[model samples]
Target: MKLTALLLSLSLTASAAIAQSDAASEARDAARDLEEAAVALQQAESSRNRIKALTQVVQSYEDGLAALREGLRRAVIRQQRLEAQLVQQEAEIARLIGVLQTLGNNNSPTLFLHPQGPTGTARAGMMLADVMPALNAEAAELRDALQEVRILRELQLGAADTLQSGLDGAQAARTALSKAISDRTDPPKRFIEDPVQTALLIAATETLEGFASGLTDMSPEPEGLAPLPDISHRRGKLDLPLEAEILLYPDETDASGVTRPGITLATRANTLVSSPVAATIRYRGPLLDLDNVMVLEPQPGLLFVFAGLGAVFGEVGEVIPTGAPLGLMGGNDPKIDAILSQSGEGSGQDRTETLYIEVRDGKTPVDPSEWFNINKDR
Candidate 1:
């Protein structure tokens, strides 16, 4: 009886161990599935966002081209008018030259004809002196008019070149966007039918702060997640997401006297936005007045908030490498818009859109300028 009981206990213990191993395997597989689903969904969303931004870029280019063409037309017209006036001035100078030559040629003859009179000679000399200054003035005026015409012609040529460049850029952007859209693979089937998480995302659309705080509760914490690098030591060493100028600094008050806790960057519409550091996306959505905002966590207790996006990419729980493309700015850039609107404006002022970024050490907001490589001027 003792031998039989010992054998039975060994069998039970072996069976229990097997069951535990199987349970662990199943849990790991389930976690893998969840991660895969999340990644697939984020990829799809990123592709969609890219397509949208590219579309906007095409539209902006079209509008910009139209504006440029109109400006060129005006410039051409002005040049034509100036050329006509220039020609008239040239003819007037020619006539004056002939008159002066005739006077010079007749000077000796006039003196011979008026041999008995010194008064006539003195009067002729005075007249010649007076006419010389007027002639010189006319010649100077003609030269000035010619220079103006030349400048206008050059401006017209420059406008044509700029317009062509813009057209080419737009076409290239469109082709890339189209190819990307076409090559996109569909996300996993399970991600599409997830109504619970979908409902939470939809409901959390009221404000950015709310969405950011509630993101932790929307899904289970990811397993085997890697930690990001320490940002506190990387001040001034960090790369900016986009090439931009700092428009507003933290602690600075705006026209409304509202002090800001973050910095605002002046960037170009359609310029690439990117991750400033390696981090997981905590929140990405439109907020009350901030447009689209992306909340990223680079460390356990630090969060980076970016706003004023026309389009956003990435999903919550997705890890992003530093300098990865995030999205693009929206709207016809005021600077670019102005460039298109005004004649003689260079393309250099394309930096127009604004991005607002805030850094939070846990729940407290801190100045982002300390953590980022801020360009004071573009």
Candidate 2:
């Protein structure tokens, strides 16, 4: 009976160990699943942000163009009215010239004496004298009106021409803005799928299963490992292509403060760099002002990666993955370095050149430091 008790005790100990192992495995699996779910959420949010930004830009261009067109229409109408007034003034001048000629013919001294008696001639002369000054004054007034109309017409025409020019410029601007908006709209065409989240999810799931399997193997009375909890049931848990870093932080004074978050990234080159959160190809082509731009969405917005020693990606809209090779660190401008050094001098910190990396949650710029694990020293 003592021998039997010893065997039972050994069996019990083994069973307890197996139970502990299974529990640990279960916790690990849960953690992995949570990480995956977080990644998916990030991707979804990134895509959504991109779409929102493109839409706003396109709408702004449309609204501006519409306003310009309306102004042009009003200008054209004013021009037409001025042109009509000019025509009327010219006709009145011609009528005045005809009246002056008729009076001159009737008042001639040879015709005045031959055609009529002394009394009639005297009366005609008085009438011509009285009317001549009035006719001359009236003619002069009509001529002045004609000149005024011409001046007014010229001014209106100039205004119309200016409006037309503005309209043409607006059209060009709208086309460019439209193209940019279109490039960002269709996701599949522009955005290369980054499978980082998906891969992490799969690996996490497999690791969990392996742990459970190991526990089962150690158990003497090996029933298959206890069933894992179902993670698939969780909502918002498996979206992919989530953003992993923010390169630029928003500024407090920008329009983003009202609608989305404002970003501090400047339009100047080398102000920031970013992980486009998708798989992309490097465009090693001709350099332009917009060089080092990665095309995150092939059809939509181009993510410009600035070039310095740190400004690595050179090509317009080249595709790149999250945390991929951006470029080496360097400062494009000396002033920025000096400013950094001055700020750090007070704290006895050495001035260092840093790369600007930005993650645009669509059009809204968010602080990338929030998402990326930049604390390598830690």
Candidate 3:
């Protein structure tokens, strides 16, 4: 009877343990369900918010289009100027060649081979000293003119390419703008609650250091954004965001005596800017003199800053896929023409759009040439 009672007690204990385990599992399941429901509710809210948040992006596209149109106009003017310059240079080069040929034929071989006497030799030497320098100078001029003509021809070809790109860029921007306006569900939300306040801070910060401080302190919360890829390993293999010419390299000092730790590309007007790697949009808007700037972080410490955009896309804290369209370079900025004129990257009067790209590791700037492919063929 005692043995029977003990078996009964053991059975009761086992049943109680099973019951507790089941209760704990149900509790965990309930918690998970609640978490999921909360996420769903947040998404619903975000979707509602995105509807009203598209104005800036649409305005950016319009700005980009205007810039592109301006760029195209400038490019045409530049092409005309280039053609005139090319014609003048070609004519000057031909004249220089003729003059050089005449000078070469002026008894130079005969004089060198047979000097009549000491007096003749001295006279010949004197003639050579005076005439040789002149000849050399003229030859140099011819060479320079020829080089200039070649460069002009290349610019002419490039001008055509730029015009085509400008047209395409404008179309792309318009389409994207329309889509962004219509699409309410997928638009990314601000990492922080107050984006205008963040934009103010970004605009107010004069230096990248200050910007970094503000951003790092913001406690950005990524909601429903995909995780970024490991971007530290891809070196010398990354393609440029645009098929544009690189005008400046890392650590190179510009005319202003400021050393840049990034690369500057001279792209066609209204050229579309894209991300080379999967990244999160850290900041978007003008910061200092750089108009319509956008910042992307591919990893925790690595950040890419692109400035001089005419229009911008993507929201802060949004995780974007590799090669995703960010925005279009502003073609309409008069400053672009000035920059191109200074850089000599334009065909004629119209300057190529300048895209200033700064890559940073933590708060420190790094050379983007080391990470990106700098091939001439793009």
Candidate 4:
């Protein structure tokens, strides 16, 4: 009355399909980049265009690190599921082992000599023939599960080294960027701010709105400087000034119950902040509690404002091209362990620093979300 074979056969009949996952494939590339991170960092530091080279290096390290963390997260979850499955199948596995052992023992005469003699023996042999495939299948599954767990364990163990390398490379790149910024010449200026006029504006303006409204008078564009191309045609398709995620949309009420007219972005620590388009720097400095603000006039009557920078680059009235470095975000870069821990929670954002962005068209605050395509980045 051994119904174990019947039960196991039933289980086999309900076998699920193999699932396809991106974790392994995407991470495989990240692993290769991690191995090369150090070399890349060294090369970047020595490059003539240190700022651009170092920026790419830092971003690449961040990408590789993110991929690695994602791989580990998925691998851990997969391993857990496999182990749980194996545990739950313990009784079935024991029965399978018993059946296997009985078949393996050539000296067990009772196996062939069923109680009803020749007729029973023939029937038992036929039943064994039918169940052999299912037993073999179950054993194969068990082997595969064990093998996968071992591979995942090895991946996790090796990850610590790769992650450390990425962290080191990222830090080195940041330092290089900082040094490069200090050495680089100031960008071309479309206008030269009168010291007295700038000082008076700063003293009189109570808010970012007031300052932005008076931007033309603070630093009027001179006649000789070439004007930047209008980006009106590219509305809703402009890149963000940095790799960031929108934390608060325009007009969203925050915990303080204050409604803001701009969007707040969450970005990684020490990451590069750039000008999204060719624009004139109306102003670049600390204002009120909004530290290190940079107001860019991309087109006549249109302005883009950025706030909360650790260090602002370029002088007021400078004309910067699209993608020019503007500033660096403030906050300590997250440790690898912290990144991995956060990855496991299914949100791979290490954005500890916040940057506020405001778009102004003809002196009125507009939603930045309408201009920047942040969804694709996320």
Candidate models: Cα lDDT each: 0.59, 0.35, 0.58, 0.76
Model 3 spans > 4 angstroms off = 1-182, 188-190, 196-200, 224-226, 332-351, 375-378
Candidate 1 backbone clash number: 0
Positional deviation of residue 243's Cα in model 3 after best superposition, in angstroms = 1.9
For residues 198-227, what per-residue lDDT tens digits would candidate 3 score against the true structure?
Answer: 877866788766786676566676665556
lDDT by residue for model 4 (282-355), tens: 88888888878988888888889999998888777888778778888888877767765665565536778889
Query: Which stretches of model 4 miss by more than 4 angstroms?
Result: 1-25, 45-48, 102-124, 216-219, 374-378
CA RMSD, predictions in order: 29.2, 35.4, 30.7, 3.4
Write the residue-wise lDDT of candidate 1 on 1-378 in tens digits: 232333334334323322211222232333333334334333444564665555445545545554454454455455555566555444444555565577568856643344537886676567566655654554555455566567656655454445545645655664555555455454111112244774567576675545555553444444555456677789766777776777788888877786768888887666667787888776676776888888777777677888998877755566767765566678753343345355434433566688988887766677676687765553
Best model per TM-score = 4
Model 1 alpha-carbon drift over 4 Å, by segment: 1-152, 164-168, 171-220, 255-257, 333-340, 343-352, 375-378
lDDT of 2 by residue, 1-378 (tens): 232333334334323322211222232333333334334333433454543333333233323322333333333343344445545444444554565567466866665562568887787678667655655554454455445445434533443343343334333433333343345533222223234532443344433223222222221221232322332242223211211222334343434442223222222212223333443432322123222323232112222222222334323223334433333233332232332223212321222332233333334444434443332232
lDDT ranking, high to low? 4, 1, 3, 2
Candidate 2 global TM-score = 0.22
Q: How close is candidate 1 to the true structure, as a TM-score?
A: 0.53
